[model samples]
Target: MAGVWRQELSSLQAGTQNSILIGIIIHSGNPKIFEPTNPRYGFGGERAVWSFTFRDSPDDFINVTVWGSTEYINSCFKSFQVGSVVEIINSKVLSRRPDDSRDMFVPTVTSPLQITVNEGNALIQFHDSEGRAHYQPLLKMPTKTMDSLRSLNYVLQNIEELRDQFIDLLVVVTFIGEVRDIISRDGRSFKCRTFEVADASTEKTISLQLWDNEWIRLSELWEPRKTVLFLADARVGYDNFKKKTIVSIARKTLITENPSVQQALDMRLAIRNRPELSPSDPYSLPSPKNITNVMTVQQITQKLNAGSTGTDERVQFFAILYASITELNLDSKDANLLLTKCALCKRMVQKDRDSCMNLDCPSGNGSREPYNLVTFNVKLNLKDDTGYLVGCRLIGKAAEQIFGCTATEFQTMKAEQRMELKWKFLLSKFDVRMQVLGPTASITRAIYNILHMSRFETAEDISFDDIIDPMRNH
Candidate 1:
């Protein structure tokens, strides 16, 4: 440390020796083990290699690669994490080749040179001086300025022209999905997380992936509908599974959480009153063509019970059930049986409160007119010869299809009329097409969502004794 000269990443030169570099670690990749070989003699033992991105200033960041024995490389990785300021002494500084094949596998940084830290030749330690605080705020600064920012709308509308290219985006996160493991072609396993983000330009949200171990861990703190991101050099490509153009975090991409930009503030304000994502939203239900399976209620239960809990498994299947509705609570006076949520914020609106009562939503303000949504959230008991599926959801447009009226129209009917509508489906066999969500850590019980319903009347299946008079039962 005594003979090494301190240098900023921007001033790094090729073949620099005895130089100290100080910066905050921004992104870290998982350590990799590879067999090394020498052309003169033979193949050497397996060695570990690790790499990370760091920056000293907002405009100066570079990729640092470390090579050494597995023990040394793992020790360095455990010692530092993203946002930790560190000092590298005597690491070789080399100019990056324009045609280097490694460029496609590592993040593109602002520096023209890269740092190589080899064990026994260089030393890396956490910065201890008061000046380390200066690098902490750099983590939130956008790698690129607003002049180059592309809104979600712009990217989507121009996806054809931008396909297979990189673009910077400023978007607000709307959904944070669970992390899943994947194996690479090289037989290495890694963890990846997919999250959705949107901007003021459009209501549509796009998904981005996190492959780096550090970013995947850091994304756990990202709150849906609240965290803003400035994604630099995000790759635009086509997703064959989703059958749409998508953006992903590539090796050249860098993400700044809640970036210090005016557009980020505006994006947050624009989406403040938007509806939040919910579980098993009917709007995102699979098309009828995709729902080919027809499993019985007992078979569905068995499949759910057999599902493993090792990963975040969100198993979804569609089935057809010929069941009679035993319980429909439309005529019940219980307040919880019928509830309303604010159309804008998707929060439950109290009966006494005209608005959602969320301070962040503009409708909650007294002067502004409040808009409420009273969607059908009715639950019904479906019974078949096999078993009874209690508390199956018959909500939204699906409920409207059976009742032959909108939720608003149904609310205007009298108690007698609501009971009349309920009796039409009660104790009668109907063909119900539904989606079933298996039990997960968040929700213990299986969720049955009725997507479509229609009466089933056939000479063979019909029974005269099943028909009952509602007035006599009342």
Candidate 2:
């Protein structure tokens, strides 16, 4: 395995590698006899994928296999296209073909733990609408290519025009071969695996998944192995590659259009009016409906503790993490009695009073004053995005980032310090764009109402209804 790559041609398997390999990462102690791990990400195929037309293939075609872990893949999952070398471990799980002939060049392994992607070789170039070959300076990056894309620092430095945003208006591409197989969860659902897509540096074969509606409409655009101007929405897709994510266009979301000689004119107009565009639209702004108010620490804690009685359930959500489903593990009878005494911090609280008896709390026993008390539990489920379902305590000071002063400090402060901290927290939310990346799993009441309400959800809903009616009519 050591110093063996430069000497001879060889086949490899499960144990350590055998003959001298083609190339390896110099940083991993494997000498880089070939492509170095890039420093500027823009050089990778993603730039090409992003800069090119959604419907077109690169002028050339290259095929490859890749590897990596599920979590790592998911992190950059939205950025690469199929076949880009996004991983360093076997990521694709393959099924045997009916003919007993194994897939020759592409990366695939039924037993994922058994395969790994270390190096690759391919031929690819830029293509046009007629399926003819050509060369282009930039390429669109597929979701799969994200892993390696960040390494191409030199590419990005050179392309100052394509900074953080990925942009592509038009380009051409070709599929390498005949249709291989169809993949779908149910027989009615349809999807496909393509031969390969390529540009100058690399060519990648990828899988294209389609739902029933898309499959029926795909034929109008399936002029494979030929070049065509692709026009439409270009979003990232996931694939088997260890380092690259898959890039795809849906029949409805995006498309490949026929080209005419006027393509050059169209290209010029596009470049002149909007030279920076690639196959993608700019990152979009969220809908106004998504905007909402933030709640005070007292209100947030109260709602989280409100779930003990099912009849008074505070609210519902579109989705909760799989681990957050407390009902699944408990007997329905005991679960109903599962009063959430913890103050969103999972601390045992005293239901008869507003505070917890656990003087052991780092925050100290909460205020002796008659404050609100309620019961709720964490929604974290092992099936959620992180997969491990354990809810953590939500601290108010942490949510608002009260530098230097804790909630206890605020409660006992000499009015001015407490007032200053409150102003800072308020300003951070309204003026400084303080966004909580995560949904408040423990929250049930509208944050704004919490700062000024005696009654909780019941009253809040009525006000919300009133606010919504006029907007709906308008």
**Winning candidate number (TM-score):** 1
Residue-level lDDT of model 1, residues 308-414, one tens digit each, is 37345666656777778899888988566556876656688988889998886667765457767677888889887658898898876567767889888988999
User: How far off is residue 251 in model 1, in Å?
Assistant: 1.2
What C-alpha lDDT values do all the predictions have? 0.78, 0.27
The clash number for model 1 is 0
Instruction: Score candidate 2 by lDDT.
Output: 0.27
Which prediction has the highest lDDT against the true structure?
Answer: 1
| C-alpha lDDT (0 to 100) for residue 357 of candidate 1 | 85
lDDT of 2 at 140: 30
State every prediction's TM-score relative to the real structure. 0.60, 0.21
